[model samples]
Target: MDFNKIKEMGLEYAEKGKNAALDLAEKGRTQAKIVNAQSKLYKAQRQLGALVYSLAKGNEENQPLVDKYIEMIANIEQEISDLKASLEPDTVIETTFEDTEEAADGTADAAAEPAEEKPEDDEAKTCPQCGAPVSDDALFCNKCGAQL
Candidate 1:
């Protein structure tokens, strides 16, 4: 109940709060670095794979060097996969590739591309009375007529 003691206690709390904030900021910066690294790795892997595919398309003579690049790309992909798995152990990552649209001759259109479907979560509220799905603004459960 001394003025000096109260000021010292307040200062201590302030310092603790400041340190916690700094720690959180450092964590944010580290997370950003991890995201940037993952993006760069993916870009590099795609570029190398494209190069190998183009080489194989042009001639058979470039097979040896293309094989080498393909091997390196595979290793890079494996490493990226392992690192991603470790970084996001609790996250479920799914990749869905759609079939390219076809032409009149039953062949795929040269310009047509496969689309990726994004997974979406249902945001509607569920009724506790009968476990029925309901709109978020509902005042009563539609099935059981129970008040929400």
Candidate 2:
């Protein structure tokens, strides 16, 4: 009830708020780093695949260049792993090239599939580009981002 006690309580809450904000900011930065590293990892893997493919087709091989790409990709993977570990368990975002490729393939397959009959209510809608379910009021396809 005392004025001094209320002021001390207010200061404690303010300090807690500041700490929470700092923790959240740090998590955001870590998440961004993880995303950047993932992007680099994907590019390096793609390049390595291309190099191997070209070399195979030409009946040749460059072990040094291939090794370099492998090393770069490994380093990026380690960095991403470390960044993910730094994040809280619930906040971690894990991804793999296989998953991404599968998702891309799924999108392509969806787009190739034919659309089904519309519902009688007119509330149900599907994306013309991808055949994904969409809200009737949506202006763009949520799955394929095609304009509706």
Candidate 3:
């Protein structure tokens, strides 16, 4: 029934929303990096394959170039692995003395309210090639690199 309490509740919800948006943005950036690394990895592998094939046809070998490609590919793979690991959802535990005090005072209901999240719609579109969820705005599937 207090106006100040209602205002505080609104501010809390707003803060939670802002934090969730920032988290989502960070996740999107990580996913984009993974996709870029995947593209580079594919290109390096293809080049290595071509070089090996040409060398076999000519009965020649370039150990140095081959080694370079191998090293580059390994590094790219490691980067992709790290980025993908970062994409894994994080578990955040946020607790403070104020939270404990509020709970003891039976005012924790404001904090207990669930954060807003976009739900999966019944009509959500999926990638035809990989069956992974794809946003309507996406030109390519994030999971399997399929054209959407």
Candidate 4:
């Protein structure tokens, strides 16, 4: 009965369907099939809007209408979930850019600070040059030949 939520869910389904259709096109599927799928998705969204309006009118005998709307909403959610599951793994790497003034200030602060002594527990077992794990008794890294 929450019209806004219903509308939002409807829009979400439409977007997911659009994306799925586009994915099909990218994989060389027929244009007619994609367009047909898009048309069905749009119709479903419109039906959802109509259902919401009908349910909001305070008709006591509209329970079946409400139930149908709920079922449609669930179907849309499932479609979106399926589409998301079919997508390939994507990695997002984010890089931050600092203002020139901030960078210069940070650099100056770093230069003024004295290096801290390493903790006793933090022994140089790993290769400092390549960071490969090494034995505690090793005098030089076997992988990079760098002295500990």
Candidate 5:
């Protein structure tokens, strides 16, 4: 084999390897985004579900809130699918962040525009869904949507 030809083939293979590594890294990053976004989405849904269950117990009209959260979850799911399809270098991944304490103050209007979330942690509560730490009295798992 000619030395120059061997050098040329090595350079080509090295370039191909670099491109493949970059693609793999992008996929890994996209997967992390998907997982984190889905976790937040489930937390939001669980909180809203608890609220609805509470309000519904008192026979209060929570359909509007329920509908809103349903739409929000749908939007999150759509974004997740979009992010999955957007692992390319030119695509932007949009993730949604929702506050889990939206209903913590026990006000109807508190559910309005949510801010950033603060995750709760406790040693006793093992989430049946994701096995993450949660509060003992939690109605829903903070990490996942497991009914406790």
Candidate 6:
């Protein structure tokens, strides 16, 4: 087993996972912003409906109610403005591992290659007594040693 090759492959996988996680986070932020905007629009429409109802039933008793509704609408509009300003999409600056100095060598780094494992060959020697396969360079079999 080549330990260096394993380490390189692990590093490559880790980098890809990191980038994917960051992309998901960015997408979530965008969706949240859109949902928030829709909620604010719905609330504003409801406030407008209340204002129209109060105007249609004008009376001295309803004057205070109309004033309160106007103030509430103003507050909601301010809140929506602030939310719009705050809901800007999070900016992400993409980076690449290939931008490093080692990547300038132009040999297409081995870490970028897919793993190609070969099957193990049958090169073991057989024990005389137990007939079990032993390592080719072994001096004796672990089980039933027959001077292998």
Q: Report lDDT (CA) for all predictions.
A: 0.47, 0.63, 0.61, 0.47, 0.58, 0.47
Cα deviation of 121 in candidate 2 (Å)? 50
Give the range of the ten consecutive residues with the poorest summed lDDT in model 3. Answer: 107-116
Candidate 3 residue-wise lDDT, 1-148, digit = tens = 6999999999999999999998787667656656666766776687778767877988987776677778868877876666665555652323322332332232222123223124646678788998998655443454565544
Residue range with the least summed lDDT across 10 consecutive positions in model 4? 91-100
lDDT of 2: 0.63
Judging by lDDT, tell me the better candidate of 3 and 6: 3
RMSD of each: 22.2, 14.5, 17.9, 29.8, 11.8, 33.2
Question: Candidate 1 on 1-148: residue-level lDDT in tens?
Answer: 6999999999999999998797566445434434544553454455545645654676534455445545544644454454344334253323200111111111121112112112333555688889999544343444555544
Q: After superposition, how far is residue 53 of candidate 6 from its true place, in Å?
A: 3.8
Q: Which stretches of candidate 4 lie over 4 Å from their true place?
A: 1-41, 58-60, 89-148
> Highest lDDT: which candidate?
2
lDDT of model 6, residue 137 = 34
Lowest-lDDT window of 10 residues in candidate 5? 96-105
In model 6, what lDDT does residue 39 have?
A: 53
Candidate 5 structure, TM-score to reference: 0.54
Better of 4 and 5 by TM-score: 5
| Candidate 6 worst ten-residue window by lDDT | 95-104
Clashing pairs in 1: none
TM-score of 3: 0.57
